[model samples]
Target: MRYKLIPFLLLTGSLHAQQTSVLFIGNSYTYANDLPNTLRQLALSLGDTVTVASSTPGGYQFVQHANYAPTLTAIASQPWDHVVLQEQSQLGALPFPVTTTQASAAQLVDTIRAHEACSMPVFYMTWGRQNGDDLNCPDFPFMCTYQGMQDALIANYTALAEENDAFVAPVGAAWSQVRALHPLIELYSGDGSHPSPAGTYLAACVFYCTLFEESCVNATFNGFIDAATAAILRGIASEVVLDDLTAWNLDVDDVDASYTSSTNNGWNAITYTHGGAGTHLWTSSDGQSYTTPDATFVFSAGGSYTISHTYTDPCGNSDTETWVREIVVGVEELEHGMWYRVYSGVPGQLEVRGLRGGEVLTLFDAQGRSVLQKQLSRSAERVVCLPGMYFWRVNDERGNFTSGSVVVR
Candidate 1:
């Protein structure tokens, strides 16, 4: 199974723009620099469309938002593609806060599902304070350092997302990376708690990749920062989200490009019967293409042909599978002067020739169910009632059998 990746490719005239709608429900961490608008601008720069709405108060928590009328109203307003939930920066990191954080998250998730079953719940993982949680650091000594607090936040946020079958933006993970690499960038404001403009910019970049599942490295929206700094932030966001999607659960829930194929006459029918979600495209080495998930194509001659199927989810994540199939045209010989060939000379019938006398011939459908069986006193042709791929076998009096496949059109 070889995979070829076409990542972040520029849209051609044939490609339609991908559109998404998201609703952010968090506090100042989300609204400080208008993160939703920032995300919208970044998506525009990337040749995609993102519609965003938010309900963020100054200092709102999941428990508060779960019962808050305005928040509930937002969830029910429209069928959002995703609804992001961010807990208070400190609450998720606190020791034994699962009751408050997990319970409220469950309630909000249930409400979101009731409104729109397909809407995904995203947990906004925030960074730890620049200095530390001085108020709670004394009692919970682990919060005395920035690293400890960030670690705790990651664990808690991951638990919440996993529990609710949701996704995590990993903004805090990206924040930690940028801080370690460029400490002078100033991700936090003077208060050491709220985000600086750069902080929010980085957060927006994370969301851009998370919600869109596209690369943010070259996005044009810098958002109140120099291009160099913005580029750094975007790179961090891309690595944290795009590279390790499983960590944030940004990867598609399920995707399988595997397909079943059968050749009839010269036309090969390919079908993707696996369960998954994505937009599918089928392409052949013979300069043929099909947008439908299942399609059939005819070959000019019998030979090995490369057939490939690629499926891209709504979030831009994609998987591809390629197969090399051999097609035969003439009769195939099994043993000394004993040859058998399955050919379609007339419509809806298979003519078996080159068969030795006194041999039993059996025909089976694609499901391996026996449709017809008879001892051939002489070579014969049978009329197939259905148009599909069928397997056939020939058995001699000695009980040895030879099997092959044929297609009816």
Candidate 2:
């Protein structure tokens, strides 16, 4: 059959909840060195039953695939979970002659849609080749910059995929990253147009990882390839981990900071009033006490202030929290203004209006100094006061207060 069966090694427990059957439609790039075969092998090793079928004629392009629309139509009729389409590498360089490729792909996609349900997803494949010497590569002069050519091809394919609402397997960039690590990996057999075994392995890994959301690290191939090649494939797979760190959730609210040791790990505090050392302290919210003795200092009235708390982890990671509480000491009941409701015919008491609560209502002078402090209950109606402007402060059981001033005649 002129078909090569490449082996795949897949890790255990790496298969996603939803397994998929895939189809590859392209030229030798899809089958070179048994890329599809290797992908099938990897899927099997991961405990997933993945069936791979490819219809690739050597040197075939999108226009060619369009011409061979019957074969593509037949393939599209199957219950395939995914279909990957690759274009000739150079077609992406310029938009002129290649618009045909896009038209063909779009038509073929429409054909596929007619036969299959709309939910079936198509994937765009990208290919890469080794850079060439500009002097010797004059014919296809642009090929000298292999990376640039690959990028152009990828961009072109990506646009087609986007237009068609297809997913993209960044195989070419994966190859480039590998080449950056070790430059010898080539997709071409000799002329940099066909894929080598290493190139095939990388392509398979990219496709498998992206399509099935499976990890390439533990992929087990069919023993067609050896350990060294498997190791390289695993390394390429690890490169896909570029997206792993984004999975972590970090939030300040998740950490508990109520105890001293807790503060060391997750909680900390800051002080504004006292100039003394360690006035602000922190502890873990886990019911542990502060390792160091600390006290919240008494604040002064009308004094500008700043109070803050900070928490940190062992890795020297930290965040700060702050609260500003101004202290107006000796704030009496008169701190808040008092008014009598005219219709009630009763003098307004600080406690009744919620300005000052409890049996005691103390008046404070303009200097915040206490003038006359009196204890009044809710039953107290007539408040006797000398004529003066006094500040009245009222507080609830929770210590939250509403304060105003009253002029007693």
Q: Which candidate leads in lDDT? A: 1
- Models 1 onward score TM values of 0.66, 0.52
- Separately for all candidates shown, the number of backbone clashes (residues 3 or more apart, or on different chains) is 0, 43
Model 1, range 363-409, lDDT digits (tens) per residue? 89878899988777666656555777777777777665566666665
Which lDDT values do the candidates have, in the order given?
0.77, 0.53
TM-score result, candidate 2: 0.52
- Indicate which candidate wins on TM-score: 1
Off by over 4 Å in 2: 1-18, 96-98, 119-121, 132-142, 184-188, 241-409
Candidate 1's C-alpha runs over 4 A off are 1-17, 95-98, 259-320, 327-409
For model 2, the local distance difference test gives 0.53
RMSD to true structure for each model, in Å? 10.8, 19.1
